[model samples]
Target: MAFGDASFLSRVRGFLIPIGLALLPCAIAPAFGAAALPEEVTVVAKGSGLFNIELETTVYRPEGPGPFPIVVINHGKAPGNPRFQGRYRPAIAARFFLARGYAVVVPMRQGFSKSSGSYIVGGCNVEGNGREQANDVVAALDWATAQPWADKSRILVVGQSHGGWTTLAFGTRGYPGVKGLVDFAGGLRQENCTSWQQGLISGAGNYGAQTTVPSLWFYGDNDSYWPTPTWKSMFEQYVAGGAKARMVAFGSFASDSHTMFGSPAGAPIWQPQVQAFLQEIGLPYEPQPAFAQYAADPAPVASGFAAIDETDRLPDASPAALEGYRVFLSHQNPRAFAFSAKGGWGSGWGRGDTRARALENCTKKAPEGACQLYAVDDEVVWAVKP
Candidate 1:
């Protein structure tokens, strides 16, 4: 059979099984256990007409008492498949945060998972699958915040691929209490530019410009589906529009097989960065001890941008601070200039004064026009010459 035939067949099979099982509920075995059990709960969210839509959520709470920060994670496009939900469990990321203290909620959208309603994709209704999914998230947050164990003030929304697209949609609608967002390979447009198409509809308007919530967008440089240039351009537009946004590209692939975020190699690089991002925005969680150490000992800020003579100017003086500096430069939208840390008199002339000032004055040095200082978090600092 053709690919479209196969997909349609799969959907039909899934739809049939659920309907058949509903008629004979006992045929399905229970999978509930401490390991499998989430702080399970249900809520009826306001949907179209008099029919109240039922939303099923799995809540994972941290060890502490009182209210803890919350992160609402949404599943990707294959909402009806248990396998899909199983793959994107918030518990994986939740355990990391729960160790530091956070409550995670994974909700099933209408017609997907245990939630009531048919799965509508593409723009079928004003509140189709995408919007309904987003609404489920908002409602989950509402439910979580009201709980005695959740911290209403510090909430974050994280989604990957299709879920990432959902996150962007939900964010544009302006959900209250969301302070930060982590988007891993989230889709922004519906051109089938990427392979991981979830049949979800794109929201109206440019989401990049509308997103004001502080967010981090991650994609593998080699991501096969979405090209880096397109991703970067979208993010750049968002940033240009005064949105608090940051983009981090890993490897050099167009699509990192959609698993870079969860890969063993990728985890080490991204997990800490994500933790740092959360901490940077005051997410109310502790970083893992090892990751915390990494955060605490960011490579030292290099000094001596002004003392070197012109003849001795080295081509790469700011090697130690390159990464942090790059992040700073990208966010500030500074003019392009050659970067050199080598000591030299002429080295600081061509570069703008603002760049010089920002990287100067580390380790008790006076603020001079020779160098500029850029600080990252409270640990890492870098000096660049103008």
Candidate 2:
């Protein structure tokens, strides 16, 4: 996520200038989007009609349309240049809602990925930053709800990390057809900014005070971004603001729980809770059989070349490469470490094809040699048997 220390982990947003609150209807133009995406957002300008931005969006739908219920899924801001961040969506959550007959809309707001615009961080005013981003979300929703295949009456808004903050901020304004809100590890952290945690707490209070929609929030104890105490305090502040909400403190998952929202393995942790929430809110909760076939790709099973800790047995590896392996072992599963006989080594983990990433990185170090996968998850993957 954007607020944490930069790491080998990869996680991944467009621009709007604001002068007012009057939002013109944003035109959804899937026909004019990038060849790969086939989706675009056209000038949903808010404020003084001063500026316009085209947003890239992705929509996932189930077969057979006819006014399907819809969910708006928001994405977090990643570190570095936002222009490089790929098309992002919480695929796991999208599939969950899709299986239950909800069409999912993911929008790349402002300067993220292929969207044209600059990301406005607004300095240390994180709450304001989120509120600003919510404007783009408003535009996305305006277009999404108007779709022929969408049932605007049944809408759910969900966000993770910075998007979580945006979801709550967006809730402050009661837009049309917003039934409920869900936040996963929400907040923006600026280590360089003073009292940023307090800023988030206050921001939650600000959103809660103006929000009438009931909400569900999920924060884990092991989240690297926001700690348990801070989130718990934020929850108390929101409730104290007289907003009705429920907080689920799901202890931990993976290496960092912040990533749980996007990982398919995280389903068992949040799905049941989400299902109950949907039922309570009078939305569709039953899973559809036809969509069941669209399940998430499972992680590769381990191949026992050697116990993962057997770095000493790593064939032809140099002392430096062996040390790197020790560090790689600390990361959670769904990870891979690549190395070559020439001692070129690299590792990768997180929400992408870590094996490929690892090998690609390792290859750069082994220019004259070939890099291969040596370890994956908790097992060694040396292609040749010892």
Candidate 3:
């Protein structure tokens, strides 16, 4: 589901090299998670009611010449324009799957970020929208399977939120080589649609009836988008239709449980579940340490400084602060640059509001004055004492 009714919604080499200078965040992946980036691939897909369009995709593989198993990770919708959704990179998922020797393929379906075509909303038909979204998935896999690095016989589809919905819908196809499906907080909840939840449930039942493969579903009580009853009913409706599925309600997580699959902290929560499920489906589950180079770097330590942008504040700064400021502007949006009186400074980059992350990192140095936001996203808010 795209974010907020309107929307919501990588590494390199022989597949490692960057696709273009424009596709990256200043050519550096955020250090908050994994410093390693992914190579971008364009998958030609028919979507947005158009004939043929290109879908932006990211591919990460272990260091080797032989073919490896494939895992296609789907992304949810982001608010506002889908064109600005940027590339989909779940750092944690990329690392976890890579450690297990599965070459990860994260695709930006038609109409997302730099991908071609517009996103198809499909009116109030949640299921129909999912089916439409699944079309792009088919195109991506068609391309991925043809690649020399891909082990076409072993494939796994995993998604979160709207991407999760797409995974479930894709399962109904019984596509060749796809062994299993994993959905984290799947489905679309449109505020404008009356009884859309039931629509989703009914659609899930329809998919369940047609689905020949097994799937694993994850939901949490603290999700701002999905309530327990709403998703539980969707699961019940699905299994009632004969789809072999297991629903894991992980209860509450951090501030919002919906963001689990993407966060590095979430690895412990979903990894074990996924590990067992992969084994049950006759897939590889043990971690392959050789793939560790593909893993994501550690996230910045949480310092509870999330709201710094709202509060105009600053700490002492040295002459070096100016250089850090330049570095801050080069990264992706939704970022923040923080400075400390103790000459400690850091920039938080990646998705979501990282103002606090920046402040927290700066705070660790025990700045002389209160650490303050020097810049946020694209704007610099620091007050230079003349």
Best by lDDT: 2
Cα-lDDT of candidate 3: 0.72
lDDT of each: 0.50, 0.73, 0.72
Q: Please give the clash total of every predicted structure, in order.
A: 25, 8, 26
- CA RMSD, predictions in order: 19.2, 10.0, 10.3
In model 2, which residue pairs have backbone atoms overlapping below 3 Å? 13-112, 14-109, 14-110, 14-111, 14-112, 15-110, 15-111, 20-47
**Model 1's lDDT to the true fold?**
0.50
Error of 1 at 385 (Å): 57
lDDT per residue (tens digit) for residues 58-102 in model 2: 777766775888888888878888898877745456557767878
Ranking by lDDT: 2, 3, 1
- For 1-386, candidate 1 gives per-residue lDDT tens digits of 11123232232111000000011111111111112213444443535457666666656654447577788877665424532343234333544565566677767666666676666554533224445456666666666777777777778888876677677667766665677778787763445334223222223225545565667778777665566665666566555654566677765531243555433234566677787777666676565452221121122333544332221343435554444334443432221122323321111111112222233223122223233233322222335434
Better of 2 and 3 by lDDT: 2
Q: What TM-score, computed on C-alpha atoms, does each candidate reach?
A: 0.56, 0.72, 0.74
Candidate 2: worst-modelled 10 consecutive residues by lDDT = 11-20
On a 0 to 100 scale, what is the lDDT of residue 147 in model 3?
76
Q: What is the lDDT of residue 109 in candidate 2?
A: 81
